[model samples]
Target: MKVEDITSSEQAIALEDQHGAHNYHPLPAVLKKGKGVFVWDVENKKYYDFLSAYSAVNQGHCHPRIVNAMTKQAETITLTSRAFHNNVLGVFEKYATEYFDFDKLLPMNTGAEAVETAIKICRKWAYEKKGIAETEAQIVVFENNFHGRTTTIISFSNDEGARKNFGPYTPGFIKIAYDDTHSLEEILKENKNIAGVLIEPIQGEAGVYTPADSFIPKVKELCNAHNVLFMADEIQTGIARTGALLAVCGKCDCQGHCERQATYSRPDLLILGKALSGGAYPVSAVLADNEVMNVIQPGQHGSTFGGNPVAAAVAMEALEVVRDEKLAQNARKLGDLFRSELNRYIVDSSVVNLVRGRGLLNAIVINDAEDSSTAWDICVALKENGLLAKPTHGNIIRFAPPLVINEEQILDCVKIITDTLKQFEK
Candidate 1:
């Protein structure tokens, strides 16, 4: 079909359905433009963006600062293949390292790339620093984890759809139950060659499963005691999507009261993406202290698009936007309001089982079977009601708006959600 023939939303959806891979089953609305907390469908219908592109657009869509940096850098120079040092890469490295409080930063193009980089760094650290034998080091991962789609990443995934027929999978990954410190401790005790524990601060793809209050600190303690690297995949929960700059900072008592405390559960290796470029570009990084990062020498691991000038410029601005705008503080306040409103609605409705999350990264569990399409149906209603959201698993819908959303917009969204849920109640 010609481009001009695609005038209606149905025609656009049909084009994608026929031409594109069926990897995603998105909401029927065809978004054509977005700004701040709202997106416009092809038919010029406006809707509150509750999903925020899976927490990638935490700074809001088409953020001016980030886009300007990207555009200027693109005009000057974009890619240099990392063979030669680009001007923006070092600047970005310094900014990112300081921002994340890490000694070094390895830039990559996507969250999955950062995760893979962390895995390699951890394993190399085990072999070179800890003197573990080659090919014997194991990393512990939690069940229901959504690290990425790489062959090595899926090797540790427990989801049948992600793993089935994709293996013969990569080995040396120990799977344990999530949010269970005792299980991790037991695994650590049994495996002397354990390299690291990679975990998401909040499991976004697994339906925003925030662990117990002490889970992060306890995991840090165990990793320290066992001499294992504590790798945090903050790609989804980082960049102020949670209350704090990072979900690891959730331990900080600075809930609109004081500045962030210096002491916190510091991950040995930090994987960041998504909001790193504020959804303007694909930018991800793995941060580590000298000791852990030094394990990988030259030519150990690298990506061509990694640390490109455009990505570097965009990421630097994106992080600045996060701090300057105090997106974390906004997420915290709005998140509290969102949960409170949803909790009130839940008291009278049977369609929603519960609402749980930290900051703007939250999800509502449906009072239906795990594999049911009730959440999808509700999302259809949400789209009709001028709000857009998607289900993570089968019966759980994650409502993560951009951190740039205001109080009035949040209240408006809450009403949309409540009204939509009430319709499902009958």
Candidate 2:
């Protein structure tokens, strides 16, 4: 069959299996289009997009404002790499740095690259400013963290699947328990060579494990006491997904930047991605104050498409959509409703153990064993029942619909989700 004429989901899956690498084992539903919080499969069957492209579509899919900005810039000029300056890049950098209350911003094309950039900045700051010996500065990370799959990142990862064959792993990392401040303090006190403490306010990939309310505050305090940089990787949890501009904003629901909020736990290095361009384009960034960021000199780090005009325009518009549409406020209100409704059903549920997350980023732990296929089967059923979700770490399913979803849509999704889970109830 001609590729253009292929209309069946089976045909699409077969084509991918034949031509594509088996790096990702996605759900069987082959989606053709997306708008707002919904996606249409190849057969024209519509389903709620619970995953939101792993929280990349926080402003919703194919948002007109972001799309228009991208297309407009593409038509004007797409790329003028760092070998020379571009007009839009400076504008985006200024807007983004001001938006996040950072002194500077480093642009990159993907989450993994941003994480790598943060790592490089942390280590360089250690040597140049912190007075740590070269190659001796170590960054502390939490267990069950998902920073990305780069070699340096996987070196410190506990996931055997991602790390098993990808060694000899890079060194200079210390792993500690999540939400444990005593361990962090102990490590920092014991090791004067520590450069930074990297954390995810809510571990999205590790089954949406939300840390204690006091956990992050204490982390920032400890980092300050030890003079270590506090780095937050908010790739999946930022951009209104956590009901705030950034996950480190905690419970603050203000429409403005979180710098002045009492709940804000400002990070020295803030790594963001996924929804930065509203899923219209690939855009990720690392933000920092001058003290922590100025360590990197020219000819040190950059990407070919890092600050392309298209990325600049799309990201600026995407962030504007988040602010103007009040998505963070919406995510906060709906998240509470979503959890309340889910809890009403989970109280007596034998199939789901619990629900946990911040804002729209949430997960339900399956009662079955981690190695069991029950969660995957339930996800397939969810697709059939008119909603789409995917399982993580075998038995935990993440549900993060677009922030554009309204009360009625979220309630409808909750019903669909609870009803689907009821089918597998013991």
Candidate 3:
């Protein structure tokens, strides 16, 4: 059958199972189109996109501004490679650096690549600037962190499924407990070879685990005291997903001038992705001031399509959408409402234990064991009831809708979610 003629969800699933890699186990709903806060399945069933493509569609699906920028740039010059100077690249770099209050930005194609780039920059800065011996720099990471699945990244991962048979792992990383400031302090005091401490402001894949408010500031203080680079991996929590422009912004949702906010704990190295292109295309970036960024000379690191014109245009427009729509403010206001509404329901709930998260990135913990299928079953039921969410770990379902969702829409979603949970109540 012709691809366009194949309209059934079963047909699409069978085709993927036959021709595609068996890597992802997606929801049964085969989506064919999406708008601001809604998606349509192949069968024309509509559902609220609670996942937002793992927080990549913060500007909403097929955002007109981002799409227009991408299409316009594609029409002119999609790629010139870093060999020749592209007009849009430098403009985007300047805009983004100023927007995020950084001095420089190193663009890449994916969140994983940006993370790897940050690692390279950190190690190089340690060797050249911090005076660490070559190959002796050790970076600290948190347990249950979800960076990406690159060989070097997965090497430090604790996920057995991702690590099994994927040895030997890369060295020079020290894993520590998440949200433990004392351990970080002890390690920083003991280890002089430490180059950087990489952390997610919120551990998204580990079930929207929001750390203590004091945790991030203490980490920044420790990194400052030890002369180590503090790298924040905001791939999933950035771009206003966490109520603020960046998760590290704490409670402030100011458009810019993050340094002026007392709640903001600035990271030396900032890694951003997912929503960088508003889910329109691949674009990720590593941002830092000149002192740390200058360590990498030209030809040391780059990608063929890293800073392409299309990516530049799309990313610029995407970030603009965030500011123009006041998505950070929207996320903050709605997130509080979301959690409050869920908490009210949880008081009498037997299936859901609690709801926790910042902004639109929230999760509900099922009262079942982590190995149980209860969360998955509820997610399937949510899909059937006109909402789309996914289970992480096993008993946790993350609910991060587009930042564009309104209060009325969110209330409707809450009803759908609560009604579905009632079906599985113990």
Q: Which ten residues in a row have the lowest lDDT in candidate 1?
A: 255-264
lDDT of 2 by residue, 354-397 (tens): 99888899899999999999999999999999999999999999
lDDT of 2: 0.93
Each prediction's total of clashing residue pairs, residues at least 3 apart in sequence or on different chains, is: 0, 0, 0
What alpha-carbon RMSD in Å does predicted model 1 have with respect to the real structure? 1.7
Q: After superposing candidate 3, which stretches have Cα over 4 Å from the reference?
A: 253-257
Full candidate order by lDDT, most accurate first: 3, 2, 1
Each prediction's whole-model lDDT (CA): 0.90, 0.93, 0.94
lDDT of 1 by residue, 153-199 (tens): 99999888888999889999998899999999988898899999999
Runs of candidate 2 exceeding 4 Å displacement: 1-3
Error of 2 at 86 (Å): 0.8
TM-score, candidate number 2:
0.99
lDDT of 2 at 125: 97
- What digit string (tens of lDDT, one per residue) describes model 3 on residues 1-426? 786887899999999999999999998989999999999988999999999999999999999989999998899989999999999999999999989999999999999999999999999999999999999999999999999998999988998878889888999999999999999999999999999999999999999999999999999999999999999999999998988889998877576335679999999999999999999999999999999999999899999999999999999999999999999889989999999999999999888988999999999999999999999999999999999999999999999999999999999999999999889877
TM-score of each: 0.97, 0.99, 0.99
